[model samples]
Target: MMQELRSRKVEESSAREDVHTAASGDQVSTESGGRTDQLRTSGWAAEGPSRPWCRPPPCFSPSSDVEVWLNRLNDYFAANEVPQDKWVAVLKSFVSDEVYVVLAEEGPTATFNELAACLKKRYGSGESELMTWMRFARRRQCPTESLEEFADPFGLCNAAQTFQRFIDEILHGLNFAYAFIDDILIASKTPSEHDGHLRELLQRLTNYGVVINVDKCVFGAPQVEFLGFLICPEGIKPLPTKVQAVLDYPLPKTYQELRRFLAMLNFYRKFLPVLHERQQEGRPPSTTSRRSRHRSLRKV
Candidate 1:
């Protein structure tokens, strides 16, 4: 009887111990779970299964249309539920090297809208509505192209020929002045002479119903930028920006890249006489040399 009583007491103690262990386990599990939740809520936890990062769109190149890029970026923000405060940072991250350099000048405190405006002002086509309509009206169908091909609504055919004809008709018999498209350059020996030339040119243009953009017109400037050259009293030179671009160009790694680099250099070849020698050196190996190299490889 004593043995049975002792066994019953032992069994009850074991059951209580088991219940206590289970309760302690439950408490520990709850505390650990609470910590995990707290860490997540405080944003201290590493990105895991619960946390996800959205991939940004392609970076904006200098050639990209800023309005289109902004529209696409806004779509990305809406789809990803990105916060407004983060938009500036996101935009700064996606701009190309050239654009990023310009944006960096704006400093970190600039808002998204401010940055967007800066980009638009710098890169956006400043064509007026009337100019756009005139170009649209002046578009002609090419003889080789079909109606469907020629009817590209967005594309504007080069209106250079039409503009040239118009300029020639208006500025005929003007010896002191010449114009390429809309850019009219009036050369003279004296300020008084230049003034006369300018007046005559303006009167001719006015007679032809040519309304010039006063803001774009530079009057009596000692030096003017025309056709990527700085024309002054002394001599013409390549623009500093164009020279800087040549300096900034990366060394070509492939034949195609080399060709493109050489082509770019050719633009300033008139100013840089040494480029002629460099171009010769940079030219691809001759057909005979290539065949010789192939034969040598085969022999090896």
Candidate 2:
């Protein structure tokens, strides 16, 4: 009976010890789990919060060309597929002076396209293709001279004289070298001659206190694209891409359109020797013109 009682106590002690071990294991696991969660939270906190889906647009200054700024905004809105109503508010935030005032005063019903049209009428140059070509052609550099500072903004006009006459006088005085607005193209038969001319040009620019964009300057190249023409050992020729713009022009339908097309063609008539003959052949017949002329001649 005593042996049986002792065996029962021993079994009770073993059961309690097993329960204690299980409780300790559970406590350890819970503590470890809590620590893991805390570490995960800290990691996310260190990385910073997630960014919002939509960001504000890049802003522009008042001096910037309104047409250019409007185009950029249009592109951005199209790409983002932003709501049309929000465009005025976004544009207002980026613009000031007359542009801002115009947008602010526009009625609530106004669309972005209407606003763009208003801005275009106010600031667009409306330059014709030929005028644009001439503007570029006026800046073409000769073989010997390389120029600098062609791209100064309006605000810096005082600092750099971007006027055509001023640029022309400077180049004309330099001899063997010339500038197209700000680009200087220096010509020389030998390396030593080129260095001398370049030195002189630099000295002249320095004397006049002209600042050049050094990063844009190219030196000693065998060929360079000046204006729209490419100059090399083979000689100057119209850029194929530029010529393609003319060739790809659609046929004119209206009389006014035909006049404009012919006027543009006249500029290149030297290259198109048979253009006048072709134009005469394409002319429509006049109503009874030959018979009327014959009657008038008989009366005379």
Candidate 3:
């Protein structure tokens, strides 16, 4: 009986030691009479009772509407056990600079509700119909040139008709001024003549409440960059900025990368001398050989 009691006490001591080691974030095991027992550090030891911590939401770039991003943010908050009051910092971190600017205007001490309200008010429920129309207008199948022809869809659309009417009403007698959808190109022989024409154009615009963005408008310049093209006395050329973008592009290694590089080069093919030679130079030897093999197989 005495021997059994001592053995039981020793077993309890060994179990206590195992618990202590496990609490200290260490895996522990005990062996007695050829039997083994293991204790793994889990729950409280490593993560400390699952306490709430500030978890930043996924990054929201400037591309999406505020409502869509906010919905995602709300989901993140709920999932991460983030409190409503602590959301401003996370929101600021997750959103774009444009969104952050608007938030800042709402004030630094603004609460999550205030931030959300401000975003909703500023960005609206989502993008408007006019905004959607503008996006569609900007899209071009070919980047080389965008021709605004008064054809089928344009003729049929109410927006186009309204735009055409607006142009006709605004510059009814101005024979020198030419307007095409969003682009307005003014031509004059001399700088002085150009200034007069510009002043007249500005006056008409001002009278009609057509506000122009000064940053986007150019007046009496020797060379002007417009619609991704640099226009000068010599000829219209691809913008130097665009050329620099191509130059700064990284060398391609993978098949996808090679294709992307070739596609970009093709955009400015006219400006690039002996583009066919470059295509030949950039083609991988293995790819060319594979194509030759395929051709031979087809013949067979």
Candidate 4:
């Protein structure tokens, strides 16, 4: 009986040991799997992550606008988070073979900004400010031309300035009416006052030889839509349609899409109090942040 009891006790102890060993193995396996997942997600695994991609800008040509082309190229690089070291190579890939030869003749460029400056010097319009002002000052109506034809001067790169000056001249000393580019807003407390104001504005425009597009004109509106906002006697507010469009936007899956999403949010940020904070939460880490994280992982 004593021998049998001792044997039973030995068997129980062995069973407990076996269970403990199995549990320990499982714990080790789970820890290893967790570490592997961490490495993969952080892009430090054997395969690493795929390089970011974006659509290349249109090829630069002699006839292309150099400043616009350079702007687009810069946007593409920023969208893809491309390293500065690859800028010259990427620029070379997007040019024609002839343009490529020209760039080669200039020798290797040390930086993207230097290459851009070289392109601007070689291909830009190079119009001086004094020449532009002189052209503006010398503008005049031809004998056979209509008022519209006379007002629109050709080769004037600063059309916005021309429009602003024209509007300011026509609306000078008008207290009740204000003009923004082509849109005019006439404010009055009563219908009679509004009628007077409108007629006065129309007369002034007529005197300046400016013709209004009747289709685009709104007459004495109590509430009006202007520049994506609804203006009423109450206050200005974002259009419901615009708000709905924002709500309907799908989750961004690419860098370009993310940028567009952020831009949309920024436009209405005045209405959204916490929008800036929310945007920061989703923003990708900067290059500096990524490098710091990499250093930390190396230490680990």
Candidate 5:
């Protein structure tokens, strides 16, 4: 019994020693391998913990102050010509269920002035009955008719009726839109679904020979960059391009041209309204100070 007890004690001592040796071995290996380089680094921290001491702060927000940081970052990206190729991928994964829409309607027979006016009223500067007519005039397989002929103001059930088969099957559950000067795109999950919407829109646009850039297209992201601005699956953010486009716009050389621009900015009233009225009235915005002018015009 005495011999057996002694043996058990010895065994336990050996086990403890082995555990100590193993831990000691790891420490020695870490210290020995660590290279001392000229570059400054948290070398002590590197050897210390398996986990980091602190996580990085979040990178973005909605305030104008935060915009300064983003502008710098975006500027770096733009100046480098480093195509934000991965940007699309990041946005796709971020907002996976969003969709973007583009509408392309053809002119069946309306002349430049009348069709142009209808386009303005229905889809242009204001969302009026005429504006709704723009939606009808551009919808997929929309019937060919003069704006005057439509009994329904919006035209979902007017001269150009919404096709039951198309809407019931496709575009049933998609939201989000991106409108260019003459066309609009509806974005969503499964390029296949979007394709269905596109086919209808394009059929009309094809008659007009309008070309769409498929490369800039994306689907199934919780967030996406559209018309050079970020739109989430649920939220709407007007692209910087949309706003900048307004600011950089040149004063028209003629009264008619001024009317055209007025028609254009009429829809952007929320962003800059009374001032927009001034611009519409033919006052040239001086390059030195648009902001002050914008403020002055607002007071007026």
Candidate 6:
């Protein structure tokens, strides 16, 4: 506490360099679909007519250049007698926007100009080169960078029906880092009131063969250390990082020391609520035990 809030900031926020990818598509019809009226009443509990692939049913495997990979997916399904939910999930990872556009453009074999125009109209920047976009999506299937955001034109958080539709946008050549995060971290809990999001997470984890260390874990326990933070029941407490920050903190014997400590925990003050008001910044928090009280002796 006293040593380092006064030192230099450690985690400096640097501007990320202007960064990268490419995609092509026409202006996507952002209009509400035929089912809009039915889906509007309740959150996700609304009753609706059944439709293939739009409902919770497994997505159909389409023939494409990706068929080789798809075959492996089929084998996995056959090899594992997982629950229906997990089965449904692995199946969902197949279809993607790149697949759709590739099949669409290849069959009709539209002129480059037409394809570009359609892509631009549907996908703005993606229209400049539809094939390029498709290849890029295939080449880099990492969901975040792909066109998933574009698929739902109208973002619907609870729409399982839309999951296939949205996922189709970026299901190819998947980068899958976030997928790992989803399995290991996000899904390792009980279902919340939010339509069993926890179940969905764990379900996905099951598909990926991801396991949670139960003894090391706090099942449904709020505030476990993940990647290094106390993700609490209440909210993200980040206990490990805070302790680290304090332990790693420099002494504030000088004015500079205060700034350094501030930099370390500036983003974390909410968790370290005691901060200055509680006079918690005097000693290094990690090593704090008993305060040495000085007895003032009066000359008799």
Model 5 sits at a Cα RMSD from the real structure of 28.4
Clashes of each: 0, 13, 0, 0, 24, 43
As for model 4, its CA RMSD to the true structure in angstroms is 31.6
- Worst 10-residue lDDT window for candidate 5 reads 139-148
Candidates sorted by lDDT, descending order? 4, 1, 3, 2, 5, 6
Number of the predicted model whose lDDT against the real structure is largest: 4
Better of 2 and 5 by lDDT: 2
Among these predicted structures, which one has the highest TM-score?
Answer: 4
lDDT of 6 by residue, 1-300 (tens): 632432212111111111111133333232433333333332211222332112110111121111112122232122212122332233223222111000011011122344345446655773345334322222211111111111111222222232232223222233221121112332222234322444554454344323444444334433334434443444444566467768876555443455566677656565566676543334334443333211111110
By summed lDDT, the worst window of 10 consecutive residues in model 2 runs over 98-107
Candidate 2 total steric clashes: 13
Alpha-carbon shift of residue 94 in model 2 (angstroms): 47
Tens digit of lDDT per residue, candidate 3, span 1-300?
Answer: 864765565456545654665689854222221211111121110111231211112212122111112222233221212122222232223222110000001002222233234334544654233333332232221112222111112212233333444444566787555554444556555667776777787677656535554555656666655445555566557888888999899866455666788798787676778887757654555646756644433332
Candidate 2 structure quality by residue, lDDT tens digits, 1-300: 864665565456545655775787743223334433453353311211232111112212122111112222333221212122332232222222111000010011222233234334543644233223222222212112211112222332221322333455445565555444455556555667767777877676555435565556667666555544555555554567767868887776554466577776665464578998777654545564655544433332
Q: Could you give candidate 5's per-residue lDDT for residues 72-140 as a string of tens digits?
A: 123212121212234334344435455555344321332233334544553455424443433333211
TM-score of each: 0.45, 0.37, 0.37, 0.47, 0.25, 0.27
Every model: Cα RMSD to truth: 25.6, 28.6, 24.3, 31.6, 28.4, 24.0
**lDDT for each residue of candidate 1 in 81-154, tens digit (9 for 90 to 100):** 21123322322222221110010000122222332344345436432332333322322211111111111122
User: What TM-score would candidate 4 get against the native?
Assistant: 0.47
lDDT of 2: 0.41
lDDT of 6: 0.31
Tell me how far the alpha carbon of residue 60 in candidate 3 is from the true structure, in angstroms, after superposition.
Answer: 23
Model 3 segments beyond 4 Å from truth? Answer: 1-183, 273-300
